[model samples]
Target: MKKNIESIFKAHLEPKEVYKGGKNIPPSDKKIYKLSSNENPLGASPKAVAAMKAALEHIDIYPDQTDMRLREALVKDFDGKLSAEQFLCGNSGSEIIDIILRAFINEGDEVIYSNPCFLPYSVFSRWYGAKTIDIPLLSPNYDLDVEGILNAITEHTKIIFLTSPNNPTGTYIPKSLLDDFLERVPKNILIVFDEVYRHFADAEDYVTALPYVLAGHNVLGLNSFSKTYGLAGQRIGYAYTTPTIANYIRLIQKPFLLPLTSIEAAIGALNDSEFIEKTVQTVLDGRKYLAQAFDNIGIKYWPSQANFFIIDPPLPEMEFTDRMMEEGIMVRPVSQFGAPGKVRITIGNQEANEACVKALLKIKS
Candidate 1:
């Protein structure tokens, strides 16, 4: 029985420490510029705030079980014939990923992703007893190695996770490149394009991968309101896929995991066009400022089309992240994302942009 307990619990444990932000420390009472996570430095939209406050009245009731209103709103907003059946509302982008893994992935199936992609792609793959196969992204730009990923597929391949303006790297796979790759990958494999950062991408040819879905391709486009919507605290995100896959995702998900306030907040967030436009402008402006500063400091970083930038400071990545924390600024070290010598910084407000640059300059790196 003791052996059986160990067996069940041990099968899905992460082999490495996943450094989620806000853990491993106490909450700082004074507001420190938090650029570690790619959150909108501007707080959530007023529209979302009002909705959440209104939802406070309904706390006694068990909230909407299926979040039908939110799903219906999404159907109309996408402008396509996106049925409510094609939508799966999860607690966060993370939960949506978890559901996808559970809904798919037979034992020993292969999950392919780029090295330096989002850590959860590997984490949750292991959680479901699926083998993880990581391929390295192209050098300097960190674009997806489309040819390499296409070649890596095997009969056992069950999933491929791609992040546009990828986390940590903040680089996107070109639409044409991805369109070609989608046409090549086997239909049996479910490919997920995690476009959580989609809102920040200013690239003209950026593909949402929705066309593939509309054409009945086996694809799942993952998105979350956490970034551009400034609703990270609300834990609201959604997945759009084929009706079959979406229904299967709904079946394994726990009942009412997404609360009333989160659902209401997400729905309200979608309507605030001005806030989103301003958020995009702020991040783009900050990106320009930070990129210029990074060049001046002789620190290596990439100019991004997304809301964050990746930098290789002159010192060890871990030491750089730690030193900045002491100076009341925190940046994420990309070592966890398989980029050992780099750091990923969110494009914060102007003040944070200045402070981060100053902190970087003060350090030896």
Candidate 2:
């Protein structure tokens, strides 16, 4: 009668450690600057806040199962190059990734991604019983290893996950490199571009994956309102691809995947062009400020096109993180992302940026 619960769930007896983001320290009297998660320090759009408040009045009603309004809004945002049918909304970009895996991955299949990239690609692939392949990035610059990725492809390769302005490292694949890679990749293998940090990228040579989708290639571009629109808590994101692929993902997704408030808020956020501009500008400014400060202090950090950048601290990464926390600053130690002895810091508002620099100076002394 003690029975065997493990027998029923044998495949997941020893689950991998779940992916985590930055830490959230509890409230205290001292001012604590949280630059852990790459959130919009300027805060959410006023329009989005208003929309969410308005939606609360009808909290009992279920959201539209079709998600037509949001998809149409996205179409308009893209200037009609992408049809509404080509877009699929999800609770977040990460959830859309899971859905993509569910739609295409078979047991014993293979998925490939760059090492030190986003953690979810590996974690989710394993969850679906797909073999995960890690292609190490080019050293010194941490750029994606296109050739290595191409060499690793086998008949069993089902998907390729690429992150631009890659998490924990902040490096991006050049447009020319991506074009070359796309041409060589088999048409049957689905390619997913996780462009969650796309809005913050100002690299002159950077290219989005939308053009590939428009060209009828087997590619999907995933985006989020969380980082740019400050809608992380709302849990809304989307993917754009060919209508056929979008339909396949939609088939696997449960109805009412997102809440009513999140849909309305995303629509409102989409319309708030001024707010998005302000948020991007703030991050750009903070990036410059922090880079210069780090240089003055002789702290080594990467040149980033994203909202956060990785730094090589003089001390061990965990020790540096602990010291930062002691100074009422919370940053991410990115060993989990495959870059041990390195730390990732989000570009915050002017006040938070200055406080972070101050903490660095204190820690250095």
**C-alpha RMSD by candidate, in order:** 2.2, 1.3
- Clashing residue pairs in candidate 2 (N, C-alpha, C atoms within 3 angstroms): none
In candidate 2, how many clashes are counted? 0
For model 2 the TM-score comes to: 0.97
lDDT of 1 by residue, 1-365 (tens): 24655566655564755646543334887557788888887989989999999999999899887767888988977975789999888888898898899888877899999988788898888887888998899886787888888888999999999888788888888888988898888889898989998888888888786888899988999999999999998998898989888887788878777899998899898888889889989988888888888888888887687888888877788888788888778788878788988888888999999989888899955
TM-score of each: 0.93, 0.97
Per residue, candidate 2 scores C-alpha lDDT tens digits across 54-101 of 999999988888789999999998999999999999988888888999
The candidate that wins on lDDT is 2
Against the true structure, candidate 1 reaches a TM-score of 0.93
C-alpha lDDT values of all predictions: 0.85, 0.90
Q: Name every residue pair that clashes in candidate 1.
A: none
